[model samples]
Target: MLVVQPRSRTVVVLAAGEGKRMKSDLPKVLHPLLGRTLVGHVLAAASAAAAEQTLVVVGHRAEQVTAHLSEIAPAALPVLQAEQHGTGHAVRLAMAAAPDATGTVVVLNGDVPLLRPETVAELIAAHESAGAAATVLTAEVADPTGLGRIVRDAVGGLERIVEERDASTEQRRIREINAGIYAFDAVRLRDALGKLTTDNDQGEEYLTDAVGLLAAAGAPVGVHVADDVTETLGCNDRVELARLRRLLADRVNEGWMRAGVSILDPATTWIDVTVDVGRDAVIDQNTQLRGATTVGAGASVGPDVTLIDTSVGPAATVLRSHAVRARVGAGASVGPYAYLRPDADLAERAKVGTFVEVKNSQLGAGAKVPHLSYVGDATIGARANIGAATIFVNYDGVRKSRTTVGEAAFVGCDSSLIAPVEIGAGAYVGAGSAVTKDVPPGALAVTRASQRVVEGWVQSRRAGTPAAEAARRAAADGEAAHHHDASGTVPGDTATD
Candidate 1:
C-alpha cells in the first residue's frame, strides 16, 4: 500500500483566556490534570504531531506559563497576546509570531488535556484530503449547553458555528458542538483572521466567525467529528477538571493493563502518564506510581505503595512502602513499611525489611537491613547483615559523614555505627555496641560499657515496693532450694529414679 504523510506545518495553541469560570489564581492552562499541566498535555500532543514548530499564545499569567513552557517544551515559542480579545485574536497574534508558517496550521485549545495526537493528525489528514480551506473538529455530545454549536448546510456540508448566546432556538437542539480545534490552510487562515471584527455583544473577535467568512467566500470548510467525545471536553471549573482527570486516569491505566501489566485494583491504582510499567508487573490496590517511575517485568508493587521518580527492577517486590528517587535492583524485597528516600539504592537480592528507612545509601547484592533501622549516608557490602534497631550515625553537629560495612559483615541488634567508621569484611559488631572506630577484617568491635551489677539494691532502696517484695521472695526460694539439695531431698528427682 502506498502511504502519504501530511505536509509539515506549524501548530498554534491558544492559551490566553483568563478562564474566569475556573476561579483559580493560576491560569487554566497551567492546571495540573494527570502528571502534567493542562497546557503541557496539549503541547505534548502538538509535538507528537510532528509540526515544524509550535506557537503558544499567552496572556493570563503569561510569565509563569512561559517559564513552564521553557521547562516542558523549550522548542516551542510563546507569543504574548497582551490583551484577551478571544480565540481569534490569540490565533492572530500567534500567526504574527510565525510569519513564515505555511502548509496546514493546526490550532488547539490549551485546556483540552485529553486530546490525543492521533486525533490531531487525523484532523490534518481529513483537511488535506478534502482540500478544504479550513477544517473544524466537532463532537456529538449528550449535552451541548454553553458550547458552540456546529451548523451544517442542508446537504450536510460545513456551514458555520453558532455560540450558545447567538444560537437560534432550533440550532440550540444540535448535539454536535464545535470542539474549537482546527486544521487550516495557513495562507487562508491568515486572510480570514485579518477580516475578523469585534462586532458581537462581547466586543471580541470570535474564531468561529472566521469559518463563516471562509464558507461565504466559496472556500470549502470541512468538519471532522471526533470519535471519542470525551477527548473534546475542555476544563471550565474544578468539577470538570476532576472529571477530566478521572477520564485520563482510566485511559492511562487501561492502556497499561492491555499491554500485560496487571492492575489488580484499577480504582485504587493511580499511574501517571509518565510512568512505565513492564509486562507481567502487578500493581496492587492503593498504589501510586508517579513522575518518571518504571516498574520492571515480574515486579509486584503495593497493597499501599507510592513511588515517585523511582525504578523497580524485574522480580522486585515492594510492599506497603513509599519511595522517592530510589532504585530497587532485581529480586530485591522492600518493606511492609520501608521508606526509601532519595538516592537509596538496593542491589539484587537485598532486603530492606519492616520499619527500615534508607536514605542516600546503597545496599550491595544480598545485603539485608532488616527491621527498625535507619541506614543513611552509608554503603553495606554484599552479603552484609544490618541487624534490627541499628542506626548509621552519619551526622555530627557540623556535617554529615558516611559509614561503610564490608562484605559478609554482621552488625548486631541495637548497634550504632558512628560515621567516619567502617566494619571490615567478616567483622562482628556486638549487640548494644556504639562503634566509633574502624575494625580490621575478621575482627570484633564492641564499644559497650563493661558488665556491672549491684546486688540487693532494689530491696534496700525500695523495701515496700512490689519489685523489692518480688526480689525477697526470689531470695527465700533460692535458700530453700539449697537446703533441699544439701539434705539430698530434691523434688521430682526421687520419683524419676
Candidate 2:
C-alpha cells in the first residue's frame, strides 16, 4: 500500500504600508518591540508554524527593511512593492514571487507582534477541514473601533468583511472583528486576487473584498475564531506598540516562571522572546534580559541589571551590573556596579567586585579583581589577586598593549601595571607602585621615591597660624617633660619615677 505526503505551505507577510502614523524615519515594520522588529515577530510565528517558504513584501524604505531581514531571517525572501497600493496589491506581489505555490498560503500583517504560532496552525487546520477557498481569522473584541467587522449570514457562515470607514452603524455594532490573518487554497487565492479591483470606498484593492467575492460565487469561505483576542491586536503608533510590549512581556515572563525560573517582580522585569532562561534561575527586579542572552541553571541575575548577548554560567551571580557580549563562568561573581564590555570572559571561581570595569580581558579560575579597578586588554592567571584602585594601563599615545599577571601573583593597592609588561608567577607588586617593566618570577616590583622627613616645616612656613601655635605648644610641653624625666619627678612634684 502507498501513503500520500502532506502538501507544502507558504507564508506571505504584508509589510509594504508606509505607516504614516508611526512618525519615524525608520520603516514601520522595522520598529522594535520587545527586542525584535515588528515584522520579525510575525516571521517567527510563520517559521514556527512550519512554513516551507516565506515571502515578505516590502515598500517605503525597502532597502532598510531588506537589510534587517538579511540579519534576522536570512532564509525568508523579500519582494519589493514599488508603489503603496494596498494590502491586496502587496499580497499580489508576494504571490508573483511564488507563482507555483500550492497547499496552504497564509497571509499575515507585519504589525501584529502578538500573533502566536498555534493560532496560525489552527487557522490552517480549519481551512483544510472545511476545504475552504479562503478562511479569515476572527475574534470577539470589546470595542471594534478602527477595525474591520465580520458579517455573518443567516446560518452563521461568513458573509463579508466590512471596513470601519465603509461599515454602517449596524455593521459597526458587530463585536467580531477581522484579524487580517488568513489561510487560502493556493489556486483559488490566485484566481480571487486576479479578480480584485479598486472599487472600495478607499479607492484601493482591499483583500477583504476577496472573501465577499468567493462567498458570492458559491465558494466555501470559513472563519476561524481565535481563543484569545489579544493575539489579534496590531499597533499603528508608539502608544499601541508599548501596550503590545507589556502584553508580550507578561506572556514571556509567565512562561519562564512556569518552567521553574524565579522572577521576583514580573512587573519590572522584561525578558525578550529570544532570551533563554534555564530552570531554577532567579531574575530579580528592574532587569532587562535581551538579545540571545542565556542564563544557566542555578544562576542569579540582578536587582538592577541589563544583559545583552551575554551568557551567565550555572551557579554564577551578577548583581547591579551591565554586560554585553560577555561570558561569566560557573561559580563566578560580578559587580555591585560592574561593566563588562565585549570580549570580557571570566573563568570559574573568578570575582569582579564593586565599581570595576573590564573590557577585552580574561580572568583565569580563582583570579580576583576586587574594589575599584579597570582591567582592559589583560590576562590574569589563576589564584592572582588584584588589589584596590589597581589599573591596567593598556593604552599609550599611539598604540594599545596587554598586561599579563602570572599565577599566584599579588598586586598591591594603588598600583598601576603599565601594559607591555608581565608580572611573573609568585611576584609581588608593592603599594603605590607604577610598574613599567616586566618582573622575574618570585621577584618584587616597586617603583616610588625614597622617604624624606620635613619636621617643623609647617611651624616655620605658616607662622601665627593654627599649625604654628599647635607646634609651639607641643615643643614647650616636650621640653618640660624632658626636665621632669631627668629629675625622675612628676610635673606636680608628687611622685618620682
User: How high is the CA lDDT of each candidate model?
Assistant: 0.92, 0.92
TM-score of each: 0.95, 0.94
In model 2, pairs of residues that clash are: none
341-452: candidate 2 lDDT, tens digit per residue = 9999999989999999999999999999988999999999998999999999999989999999999999999999999999999899999899999999899998988999
Candidate 1 accuracy as TM-score: 0.95
Model 2 vs. true fold: TM: 0.94
* Predictions: Cα RMSD each: 2.1, 3.4
Q: Provide the lowest-lDDT 10-residue window in model 1.
A: 1-10
RMSD (CA, angstroms), candidate 2: 3.4
lDDT of 1 by residue, 1-497 (tens): 11237576899998888889999899999998778999999988776557889999999889999999999999999999888998889899999889998999999999999998888878888888999999999999999999999999989987888888888999999999999899999999999999999887678889999999999898999999999999899999999999999999999999999999999999888888899999999999999999999999999999999999999999999999999999999999999999999999999999999999999999999999989999999999999999999999999989999999999999999999999998999899999999999999899998889999999899889889999999999999999999999998887886559
The true-structure Cα RMSD of candidate 1 reads 2.1
